[model samples]
Each structure stands twice: as structure tokens, then as C-alpha cells.
Target: MANKRGNVWIAVSGVVENENGDWLVVKKKYGGLKGKWSFPAGFVNEGETLDEAIVREIHEETGIEAEVQGVIGIRSGVIQSTISDNMIIFKLKANSSKIIVQEDELFEAAFFPPNFLKDDEDASLLLQSFAEEMFEKMLYKIDGLNPGDQFGYTSYRLFL
Candidate 1:
């Protein structure tokens, strides 16, 4: 996965949670993140919006249709020698709890409760940090706070 400095794949993902209050995660089957646990995600196709991509990826990976609740924030990083110049991260909320595994793209799927990351798929510390940041952002967003609002340590950027 040799990365080009300015060229990168456009990817979308779903930060889904179930009734048990656990976040849904999957183990990627192929590519740079193969065998690692991550939120259901995929490359955005030729003609699709970020929201559409997230919905499609969610259904394709988990066999469940999810509703787009909100945008947590965008995260960009380098991997496979690529800079991910056009990457888009989306935080989604789901309505279905009956998740079916799509073996070709993901080996397994499950819900993880907060603070329980024993099966974290990402091995890179950089990605882990990004996940933590996203979670913080999610918390803020779920609590109905403006991420940019100057509310002491309540903001995602400041919390981390």
C-alpha cells in the first residue's frame, strides 16, 4: 500500500451503536486494515455523497440499514504511504440491532461498550488516537453541544 503524498482514497464509515449501548465494530477482511477491528467503512465510489457512502458502507458491511444522525468531525491521516487527502469520517446512528456479518468484507462484527476496547482492530497508535478523538466528539455531539463552543473542557478538542 504505497502511499502518494497528495493522492489518497476517499473513504466513509459508520460509528454505529446498538441497544446495549455498545459501538458496532468490524474486522476488515482486506487492504491495509485487514484483520484489524474498525467501524464499518469503505471507499467512496464515483458518484456518491459522503452521507450516501456511509449508509451504503454500513449496509454492505453489516447487513443493516442505519440512519445518519450527525457528523462528529473529519479526521485525516497517512497510511499505506498515502496521505488520505480526501478522507471523510462520519459518525452515524443506527436503528437496527440485527447485524449480519458480510464475510467477504468483514470477518466478524460486534458491539463494544464504552471503555471496552479489548478487541480494537487498529494497531497503529495514530489511528487509536483518532478513534479516541472521535469518541470525544461523539460524546459532545450526543450531549447536544457545539463542538466549537468555548465551554471549558466540554469540547472534543479541549477534552483530549
Candidate 2:
């Protein structure tokens, strides 16, 4: 495990699903990445594995119990602020339906098609850029109809 700058933070996100096949994205209310559109995610607690963090974060943030299907991918990026220096991004595919927001941590919760990030107005520019970049990579992979050389990007693992 790589440590960022000096601070260590591990975060897990769940790509939860509904019966209609739409994915869920939550509007973060506070924190460095606040106001951005993202899947349900949070820090990894003591004695927890990656999957455990995924299940815990999903339940805590979205009020949904998710049975994780598999790993999406892991992303690590630098935090440009003084508060934190790094972020470990875990994307997980989860089986879920009901979503109950924990009020203080999120602003709004909604489900949309996997491509919804393309048209979201409230998503931060950084997030939109990341999402778009990942989406394009995924589209190309799908066009090729192969997962080979396609699992390296952020969107490929998260959007499926």
C-alpha cells in the first residue's frame, strides 16, 4: 500500500444498482470533495478489508445493504489541500435497491443511467473530467468488445 505525501486515507465506493438497472450517485454535502457527484464511499476502518469497507461505506452513506459482486478498480490521487494529501478510490459493484441518506453527509441522492455523469450539472469540473475520461475509455473498450487493456482506467471498473 502506497502512502500519499504523509497522510494515509483509504476510501471505498459502491456502484449500487436498482431493479431498473440504473446506478446511484450521491451529492456530497461536506468535505474536500464536497458538492461533487460520486458513488457511495468512505474511509476504511481498522480490521476491515476492501470489500468490508465497501459494504460498510455503502450502508453508512446510502443506507443500503450491498452484496459486492467484484472489484471495479483502485485509484489513487493527490489531494491539493492541506487537510489531506491522498485518496484511495475503490470502485465496487453492489446489489442494492433502497437508499436512505444519512442527512449530514449527503445533499441529495438519486439513481440514473450509468452515463448520467455526462449531463450532471452539479458534478465538479474535476469529477466530470475524470468521469468523462473514464467513460470514453469504457466506450472504446466496449467497441472493441474486450476487457483486455481496458481495466486500467477509472470509469471502466465503475460504470459496468
Residue pairs whose backbone atoms clash in candidate 2: none
The residue-by-residue lDDT of candidate 1 on 1-160, one tens digit each, is: 4544337767776677666767778887787678777777777776666677888988988887787765665657765564554555565677888889998778888877645554354533424554565455442223344555466533232211
Error of model 2, residue 125, in angstroms: 6.1
**Candidate 2: misplaced stretches above 4 Å?**
1-6, 80-94, 124-160
Scanning candidate 2 in windows of ten residues, the lowest lDDT window is: 135-144
Candidate 1 deviant stretches above 4 angstroms: 1-6, 78-85, 118-127, 130-160
Clashes of 2: 0
**Per-residue lDDT of 134 in model 1:** 46
Task: Estimate TM-scores for all models.
Answer: 0.68, 0.65
RMSD of 1: 8.4
Global CA lDDT computed for model 2? 0.62
Q: Which is the leading candidate under TM-score?
A: 1
The count of backbone overlaps in candidate 1 is 3
Q: Candidate 1: lDDT over CA atoms?
A: 0.66
